[model samples]
Target: MIRASGISLRRGVKVLLDQSEFTIHPGERVGLVGKNGAGKTTLFALLQGELDLDAGHLSMPESWRIASVEQHIADRDRPAREFVIDGDRDLRRLQDQRAATHDDDGQRIAELEAALLEADAWTAPSRAEQLLAGLGFKPEEWLLPVGHFSGGWQMRLALARALMAPSDLLLLDEPTNHLDLDAMLWLERWLVSYPGTVLLISHDTEFLDAVAKAILHIDHHKLVRYKGGYHDFIMQRAERMQQAQIAYQRQTREAARLQSFIDRFKAQATKAKQAQSRVKALSRMQLLAPLKEDSSISIQLPSPTYVPDPLLTLDKADLGYGSTAILKNVQLMVRGGGRIGILGMNGAGKSTLIKTLAGQQAPLSGEKVAAKGLEIGYFAQHQLDMIDPDSSPLQHLARLAPDVREQELRNYLGSFGFSGDMASNPTAPFSGGEKARLALALIVWQKPNLLLLDEPTNHLDVDTREALATALAGYEGSVLLVSHDRHLLRSTVDEFWIVADGQVQEFDGDLEDYRDWLLSRNASARADARKETRALQQDDSNSVDRRTQRRQEAETRQRLAQLRKPLDKQLGKIESQMEKTGERLQELDLLMQDPNFYTDQYKDERPQLLAEHGELSKQHTELEEQWLDLQEQIETLAQSDH
Candidate 1:
């Protein structure tokens, strides 16, 4: 368990936490949430012991291991798989020790080998490859040098490295920021199955709802604990605020009554004692602070002057870079008020199609038709970079509408959360969220009939994201959105377009259906690869002499059997252990389900039972992973035999 008792934390003059206390039990998955700059990251630093609390003590088990993604990765010519494998520090240390030991030292060598096996050192490469694959890296890319990738890909590598580590606690800050829909789904599954305690900071509400079991919110320099996921936290917090408001109103009425009595009778000798007593009573009352809600953004997308059916159309489009096609023979149309979401794996031509439609890139070999009054407001991450840093939000808007008055421009910017100084200040010092809002503001100011948005909610906070979704929901124009944020997608889009296998087509279902489709497709691909491997092996064998082939096959079987014997034994033992652990967990669940088990009658034994349950759960998760790894090894051997 991790506990902070009345802890006080500060960053320079800013007091982020003042005597705040919270406790996180073992194996709990927690989401740490707050507005930007509200000290969510600072709290992570405090937990890692990189920063000290000014007052009170933070305590956790000394033996607990922690893993977190590095903010910066050196651009080195190191194999990506090897870089991720290094995250397993214990495995690397064991390998190093073995290297330093002499072969003649038989006993020492034996001990090292046993230690390595216990640490799963031999399977580290496969594990690293699996992590990389889940994070959107292809098999061929795994052997490439880390420096060969771009910054976003480097961040994905960093995330993979963090996930590769064996730790008792995991801290992920915006882990999904660099991932696409498929990668994000894979990560959600990984985190859900993770046995350790997790502390995550993310603005992606759907992700938090999927992976977080609890929520830790930072508000008014205090850490507030809620009992469930993001949606639960919102409801619970709203109820709490409502209760507080009621209490404050009641107190106010009482105070007014007391003051009325005092004012009415203070001058009379008849009620002097009562007035004095009322004065003390009023003084003794603990006043409740008025509730202050976070300010919300209100976005109004200017209505288009004209709406035309089939705002844009693509015919026999081969979309890609020069001389290379990503999506071929694509035929699609965007009608007025149509809402379509583009879905695909990373580098699967979603962006290519958008770019072609936005006229940022010409179709390699096709024709695009646009309505006479068609206007497009294309917003991409790169557009934020194109904005001049020296200009303010108002200046950016003024450039878009040169003849508009300054007050009108400022008022329009204010609707997008840029008011007064924020509207006029140079955007050089603004945060990513601020820049994204400004970019959207500029797009909205144009009143385009068609909106082509690519990952527009990447840097937005929860409130801002909600605002955008709400605005887009009500906007009277067509929308083509590509986003990993499922909440935004569900709220804003009505249909889906899938880009895969160099073709573009309409998908028949929702996001859940897409996930199932992706999983099934991957499984089929793996099966095909195995079949191809077998076919090639068969051809090679047919070329050899029949007698020689028989002899070689017999020897290979004997060698493979010898190799599989010990692994089979280990696999059985792990399976037995898993069964036992799972039974115990079921028993604990049954006991805890009894309403009386949590009452005072069983209070003395509850902690022990809960602790045992946590330990068993963690053990079961580790055993399951071992079981999978063993299966993979057996499968590899079988493939080699083929």
Candidate 2:
């Protein structure tokens, strides 16, 4: 267990915490949350012994090992797997010592081997591989040098290294920042099953709710611990704030009444003694201070002046870099006021599709048609960095709307959290959240009819994220969001476009459905890979003439089609039934929402409706599972034939 007693922490002259106390038990997963620059990182630094407390005492089990993702990794010419494996320092040390030991040193060699076995060194490589894979690393890239990976991939490697460590405590800071939805899901599951205690700093609400067993929030220079998940914390904290507000209001009224009596009676001879007693009581009274509400920003993007019926259209487009097609045969249409979210694995062409739609990159083939008087506002990671650091937010907005009034621009900037001197100060020293706000302000200032936001919430805090979601929800413009933020996706987008297998198509499901599909796809992929390997090994020496092979392949495909006919027919029937069942269930759900549906008069009918609803739901679940299994089987067989 870890304990902090009367701990005072400070950075420079600013005191973040004054005599704060908290206790963390072993195997507890705690989430540390606060506003950006609220000393969350400082607390982590203090725990890791990189910084000392200004006062008081902090203690934990001295023998426990700690693991955390390194912020920076030097460019090294080492295999990625080897770099991850080295995260287990004790195992590496033993291996290194064993390599240098002489044949005569039998005792030392035996001890080293025993230590290696205890460390589970033999399975280290496979464990490292699994960690890397879960973080979106391909099998072929496992042997590549660490220097070959880009910054985001390097961050993934850093996370994988931390996960590879055998430790008593694990500390993660925004582990899902660079990950795609698939990778995020995998990491969440991995962390949930992690045996060690975890203390994570994340702005992702869903991630915290999924993984954190407890929440430690920093409010007004004090640490407040909550007993449950993030949602529970939010609800409980709100209740606490409400009760505190009542107490504070009551105290203020009592103090005012006491003062009023003292003032009125002080001049009267009969009440002089009472007034003096009241004075003494007033002086001794402990007044409760009103709670300070958190400063939350508000964002409202301006609606476009004119929204064309169809904003843009893509016809048989092949999207990618020169000579490298990432997404092929893409046919998509964007209408006014449409909201679409793009979903895919990392490097599976989600960005490519966004870039192509945004006109940052032209399609290698086919046509991209924009409606008359079309305008676009594109926001990506680069957009944040593209803001002039030497200039202020006012200057940036001024550049976009040179003819607009300065005060009006300031007001607009203020809504995005850049108020007063913040709008005038140079952005060079601004934090990431500030820069992101500026970038968004610039984008919204343009009043474009279409918005393409790629990971817009990356540098945003929870408040800002909610504000962005609200703004996007109310904005009357076409939006295509490429993000891993599930809450944002759910709130903003009405439909989903999945970019996978070198193609783009509308997914007939939500984020949860996409997750299940990813898991099923991954399993099918593994089975296909194994089958391919076996077939290749057996036919290693076989060769056929090109023309003869083409004919045979045609015939084989025809035979496979015939074999798939019954399964395809059964799938059609199942899908038709599912569609009808879904519609009927929705009707029943709506009917149940009526005010009089559960009243005494209709109570008899309610049981029948309830029974039918329950039976339908069970039938739907069984059918859905059956459909999934059959789909997987068909896919596996199709892949085997290919």
Candidate 3:
């Protein structure tokens, strides 16, 4: 357990924590949350002993080992796997000592080997590989140098290195920022099973809720603890705010009443005694200030002037780069007011599809159809970097709408949480979140009928994410979003499309269902790989007599066919059912588009329609999982026969 008693911390002239006291029990996954510049990162530095507290003490077990992700990687030439293995400092030190030992020192070498075994140093490479795979690195990329990857991919390696360490406590700051949906879900599962305590600082509300057992918030120059996840924190905080507001209102009313009485009597000598008593009463009262809510940014996407049906369409689209087709036989339609979320594994052509739809990349051999006056607003991770560092938010807006008044542009920037000097200041020094907001503000300022957003919430805080979701919900334009933020997906998008296996198809389920499907697919793929390895070994052993080999091969083929036949049949049935579910979902979506379906007159019928949609979605998910299981079983049977 970790305990803090009467701690005081300051940075420059600003006080971050004042007499703060808290205790974190062993194995508790605690989330640290605060607004920007509220000193959450400073608190992390203090905990890591990089910064000293001004007063009081912090205590923890002396024997406990701690591990954290390094923000900098200086050795670019090192292999990624080796860099991760080095995270186990003790293991690395033992290896170094063994390397320095003299050849004749048998006794010392034996001792070192025993120590290495005790530390599980022999399995370090395999453990590091697993971490890399879970963080979305391909098998072929494991041996590559750390410098070969982009900045975001390098950050993933840093995260993998932290997870590779053997420690009693783990500190992760925004681990999911560089991860896609599949990798993020994998990390969530890994953290849930991790034996050590976790101290996570992240702005992703859904992730925090999924992994954290408790929440620690910084408010009003004090640290406050809450008993549960992000949603629980919100509920408890809202209640506290309500109570505080009530007390403040009551005190203000009483103070006003006393002042009124004193004001009316202080001028008259006959009521001087009454006035003096009222004055004393007012002076004795302790005034309570109103509770201030957390500040949040509000985004308002400009409405388009014209919204036509069938805003865009892709006919037999083959999407990829150059001659390589990442996705084929794709057919997608975007109608007015449609909201769709794209789901897929990292590098599974999600971005390729989005780029094709946004007209940034042309389809290899198919036609992209757009309405006569269709306008698209595309938002992607690269868009943030495209912002002119020397330009302010106001300047960016002016470039988009040059005829508009300067004051009008400033007012629009203020709605997205940039006002006063911030709107006028150059964006070069802004944090990632600010840059992302500015990029999104530029996109939102354009009144486009179709919006294509890719990972738009990458650097946004919880408040900004909520605001974005709310704006998307209220916008009259159609939107296609690809994001790992499950909360935003669940709240904004009505349906999802999955990109996988060189094909694009409409997914008939929700985010939870997509997670289950990903797990099943991974299991099936692993089983297939094992089966392939066994077959390769069988092929290599041709030294046996030709007659004997031929007979064995024939028997293996017969047995494998028998084992796979039933599984194939089941897979066919599942595929058929999934198709039906997809069609039904599309029908329901059309029904939902009718304005009268949401009116008071048809409220009674709405629940039945929603219930049917829910039933179909559940069935589709179960079928997909079943299909994956059957595929894995067939692969295992084939390996056994070999």
Candidate 4:
């Protein structure tokens, strides 16, 4: 366990955190949430002892071990397994020395054996593999050189190494940044079941909601604590704020009336004491200024004109890298009026399939025939690679679309949230999301018939997500695209194509259907895992069996316990959440009341909070039901006691 008491962090004169207090207990998963550049990373650094505090103290068990979800990996050429083992050099050295001795050095052997036992070295490799797989890595990927993977995959590998490490505290900064949805879900499961304390910084709402039991908010150089998940935190924060608001209003009105009376009768000897008393009350009253919560998703999107008719088609398409077929013979078509989504795992050939049709890559021994007179514009996920670092956004737009007027170009970029001083700045300075949007602007400026897009919404905000969804919905050409955002895919794409097992197949449905199928698949996998674990346990209590079977059963039981608690507790948590959500709605109502709606407050924040609550309610209900079923199962298993 670790605790930071009255901590204040400062950089020269600027304070990052002021008088912050937080307790991180063993097995507590905490999420640090705030806007970009709001000290989330800085907090992690402070916790890791990489950043010094200006005041107060941070304390933890002296023997506590710490590991970071390393953002930068130094071992590029090393095997992934080597990286995992080498996480703690002392442990690795002890294991190696212990293995080499064959009764050659009795005392040294004894010492090494003691060290291995203390380090739990016997189970380390297996645990590493398990963690790696949980983080969406295949067994073979463990042997691949870290340098060979993309930046995203490399980050995941680093994170995998850290998760595999035996540590008392895990400090993760933006751990969800490079992960696809599958990997994110995998990480979430591990975090929830993990016995160690976790300090996770992530922008993914679903990840935080699922894994974090407590939320630590860093804002305005101050830290605040809420005793539940992200949704609960927001709701609790809202309710408290609303209560404070009502109290303040009532007090302020009384003070104002008293002041009026004093002002009217201050000169009269009979009323002077009453007037002064009212003024004193006003001075002592504490004002509760509202906190703005919706700054993260505010984005300006431009509406585009739609063109008519089907823009392109793919006939008997085969896409792959070199002679190795990533996708077998595939047939696909996109009509002008409908939105389409391409879905798959990290290496599922979704991008490659689109690339082959767009002429970015050649198919393996198969023809990709596009419709006649089709003008195809392609935006690859690696569009940033195509950008000339030296060119400005304006320069790039001008070079790509020479006929467009400067004002038109500026307007286009502005629509995508690159406006004013930001528009003329060098494209090299833009963030990943900015670069992605700029590339999109370039692709759409050409007015091509068929659009081939790969990972189009990788780093976009929710507002931009909705905006782009609307734009794609109206685009005249057919959209052959791949994106990870379920919300965007739900509105923009009409059908889904799943590329797996060296083939591409069309699945006619939306994201909702995909989610339902995945949940059922997960339930089946969970059942199978539990069954296998039990069989292995009954076979033996070897380290592997104990870890795999006994540990799993224990974890399932723990989850069951949390779910089976009294209904009063469940309803209390929900009602607490409801009060705060009601306050958030009230705040949004105020924002909606404004015709301009351009203030610093969260205009759309309330709606998102409400939707998040619906999800939380569902999860709570499901968990409760699962608990009841598991209880019955446990009782049945113990029937021999009778």
Q: List, residue by residue over 46-97, the lDDT tens digit for candidate 2.
A: 9999999998899999998999999989856889999999899989999999
lDDT of 4 at 498: 77
For every model shown, what is its TM-score relative to the native structure?
Answer: 0.83, 0.82, 0.79, 0.70
Measure candidate 2: CA RMSD.
21.9
Lowest lDDT sum, 10 consecutive residues, model 3, at: 105-114
Off by over 4 Å in 3: 13-15, 250-287, 533-642
Query: Once model 4 is optimally superposed onto the true structure by TM-score, how far is the C-alpha of residue 289 displaced, in angstroms?
Result: 2.3
Q: Residue 276 in candidate 2 has what lDDT?
A: 94
Best by lDDT: 1
lDDT of each: 0.90, 0.89, 0.88, 0.71
Question: What are the C-alpha RMSDs, in order, of all predicted structures?
Answer: 12.4, 21.9, 23.7, 22.3
lDDT tens digits by residue: candidate 3, 423-476: 999999888888999988888787889999999988787788889999988999
Best candidate according to TM-score: 1
Model 4: pairs clashing at backbone N, Cα or C within 3 Å: 339-494
Give Cα distance to truth, residue 162, candidate 2, Å. 0.5
Tell me the lDDT of candidate 2. 0.89
The alpha-carbon lDDT assigned to residue 611 of candidate 2 equals 93
Over 4 Å off, model 2: 264-277, 529-642
TM-score of 2: 0.82
Candidate 4 lDDT tens digits, 1-642: 678899998766767888888887888899887654567778888777798888899988978788887766887999877787777667887877877877545445544654676687767787777766666676568788879888888888788778767788988877776666667667777877778889887655556788898998886777888888877987998897788678778877876787788789889898888878877877887765545554332233333345445444555655677668777667665666556677777787877777777877777765555556667778876787888777888888888779879998888877776677778877776666677788888877766767778877665543455567787776656777776655566667777787767777777666657656656765776688679879888666655554587677787665444333433344456566656656655665565677665554656665675576566556656655655644554453344223
TM-score of 4: 0.70
